[model samples]
Target: MGLQNITGLFYPSQTLGGPHIDIEDIITSQNVISRVMHSYLGILVPLGLLAGVICVAILIRNKVKHQTLENLDLHLLALVATDITIVFYSFTSKTRPDYLEVSNLSCGVLSWFFNTSYFFSQYLLVLMILILLILDDSKTSQSHLRYVFLTLTLSIVMSVVNVSLLGTYDNLHNITYCQLDPLNARPEYDFTKFFAGFCVPSLVLLIFVILIIIRAREVEMSEKLQAHGVVLCHVPIMFICRLFYNIMLIRRTGLKINAFYMSPREELVLNIAELAVFSGSCIGLIITLALHKPCRQGLKKSLQFLINKCRGKETSNSVI
Candidate 1:
């Protein structure tokens, strides 16, 4: 898709070694690129699905046999699992056979799961980090309860607002299955609504995450575990990704294809955001599981068993 988007965006006039592709004639070129990219996706789908299955097996086993995860963190795991599913499905998504168009429902469902998990996970993570960062207080349980409720309430409100403001999940880019509906690109677009609903909230979360990181660093721990660093890394990744994505979303009116369509500056930010998003979930899992001895050991063992089973199945299939 990135390659195709680039080919479309940079339509040079004359060919030095190849054909001329001037930026003026974009629509025709874009259609050509889109068709080629769509065909390429047919080959990419099988590999993507295989990888998704492996990732799902790992997450499922980790969820089932996790011994050291705090009871409160189950929701966190659920969010993480859902994220994997969302991305995996989105990556392997295909077009319908009849009209050569992707199913809006599949794309929408994946997008919904991804976005909903994102907000709620951050909501939970921020609360957890706050509790850990701040000094001891007597009403920890009550305060924690309130925090959970507040986060849930906020999630619900934001979701409703998103549906109302951004239109339903049906609004998606045809080529990139994972892209978000830009607020500015909506039917009755309002810049204020866009900034307030998505942009401002992300900025606020970033500020809070920074403060938490600073406070956490200042305090000395009895155990001196490096887990704090791992946790801190997770929040910043989310903040950075949200910030990068939202900003580019406003800065560009063209399209969100790939690195090619972007200005040099936009390109840099896009790369960073993509990396942060990709690393956010898996790295967080690695950190959380690796930080605790029991979880680290248990997950490693479970993964080994799963891998062995997959290999056995592959062998059986090959024989048959």
Candidate 2:
């Protein structure tokens, strides 16, 4: 019998005794790693983002100066600022909970912060590439603005739906910590809402990005300035990293209630996915710096100036 085989197999089903692990163990392991990775970025990426802001400033200095930035550039900067702030507050800052002092309403606020920035950044990037395509006299049926509007509407609805989680906001256990869903939570956490609010739209955006990249390469235009290709390359890699992290978090949840070990291959996949995302951000910076000359020169000058200022400050400190 199948049961006989399982029972009789090699070591036998019976065991002496060992410590049992639950979902908490799994979630804890995953979150510890996730928090560590996020913390690492909290320290390093702010500098990178500052560099990016400087580059953006230089790009617009001749035309608009610091008073204003090109719409795309401004959106990109805002996206970076929000994302960096979220990660820093969520993972790095010792006093991060201070920001939540007013209320526990911030239960998942950081996730929303990152989500909004990520969604906006993606839409803005796509819009930028769309503009590039249009300015080149390319033909298009649906307008970029139309799609942008649609993306916004859908994203807003989805976000609102997700935020409708009807449970007591437990500050200690919320925001970046994995825990069992508050089962009794009302109509908000329904399966339909979960799919509509997150999965479906995300998949749509993912496909749209892929299509843009392919179309960009195929379409004939004056200099073949295909920026969409860069976005295509960027999103998948970022998605992989976040996806890996999510998988680990999910896996840990399952482990909390069950006893099991993941295959070595699965573990490898998760690590590779997470690292790929971190590296993807660096890749994006490089691509932007390379493709946009104004940005590159601006960033270089900013870094040099910052370095000099640091040296000057250190010299003064030593003298004191």
Candidate 3:
């Protein structure tokens, strides 16, 4: 369907290069829209890495202090790990101007990792929601272990299959980046992609939201406005951004074939959608830091410790 095609949500085509791409045009002829997309990616890469680093530090400190993983922290750490991979792949793809020009095993593998990490992140969130719904604090640690094992095992298997079936970037789609070809996509491809990538997670998330509302109504749980709910609720924003981006891609392709055929107006709208995807990903981590009380408290301690260390150093210097 035209709508599906616009989403740019499916796997890459198995075929290699279609038409001869002019590298010069890609580099020199990028309009303002393409440049803005490039800029968004450039910023997102670093922002994602910073989020990962902050989370890692907090996780480690908590582990050392408590001598065991806390329920919320363990799940959050899993998310941070996935966020690192997603960020790394985004950084690599965005930083290299020649990413599309190169077709090597490493490049293909990186593409595979990017897709896998995204899927794993979504799956992990679904798992976390289930944990919150099903288990109390006592069983959460055990559940987290099982969740991690399952998510990792499934992520590896599905990513390998996705790459094997779909292949990798065939050509430089545009100045901003290249991606899987929608033209060569099969019907089965869309089903598998939609099921794993969108459908299951969305359904689970909706159910999770409904459950939260019901629980709030039944029991006036004052703690409902706390960190966990805030962090979990923020996930839907990412999903909505991704959904819109794919829809726009469908719209763009319906209008014309590729970036080469994109009008300035169409290109601008496409870039705007692209920015939403980037922003949504970054916002997840930001929300974690902002709303997750444990992470916030750890950050506060870490900051105060640094300040004390600085003061001690200054005192020693004066004494000397």
Number of the top-ranking candidate, with TM-score as the measure: 3
Tens digits of per-residue lDDT, candidate 1, 1-320, equal: 12112123321211111233334353344354345435435543344344334444554565567633332344344445544543453333233111122334344444445556556666666665554555333454445556667876776566545445443334344332224332123432223334644566566566766665555445353222244454455566566655665565555534423323443334334333433444455445545555544445655787899999999999999999
State in Å the error of residue 132, model 1.
Answer: 1.8
Could you tell me the C-alpha RMSD of candidate 1 in Å?
A: 9.2
Model 3: per-residue Cα lDDT over 64-178, one tens digit each: 9888888778888887777666555444434222224333334445546766776788888877776665545667577768878898788777766656544223432322234
Error of 2 at 100 (Å): 10
What would you estimate as the lDDT of candidate 2? 0.44
Model 1: how far is 203 from its true place, Å?
A: 4.1
Question: Residue 82 in candidate 2 has what lDDT?
Answer: 36
Runs of candidate 2 with Cα error greater than 4 angstroms are 1-19, 22-43, 59-75, 89-104, 125-157, 169-202, 209-230, 249-287, 301-320
Q: Residues 209-251, candidate 2, lDDT per residue (tens digit)?
A: 5554565555463244442344444456455555555555455
Task: Evaluate model 1: give its lDDT.
Answer: 0.46
Alpha carbon lDDT of residue 150, candidate 1?
Answer: 81
Worst 10 residues of 1 by lDDT: 9-18
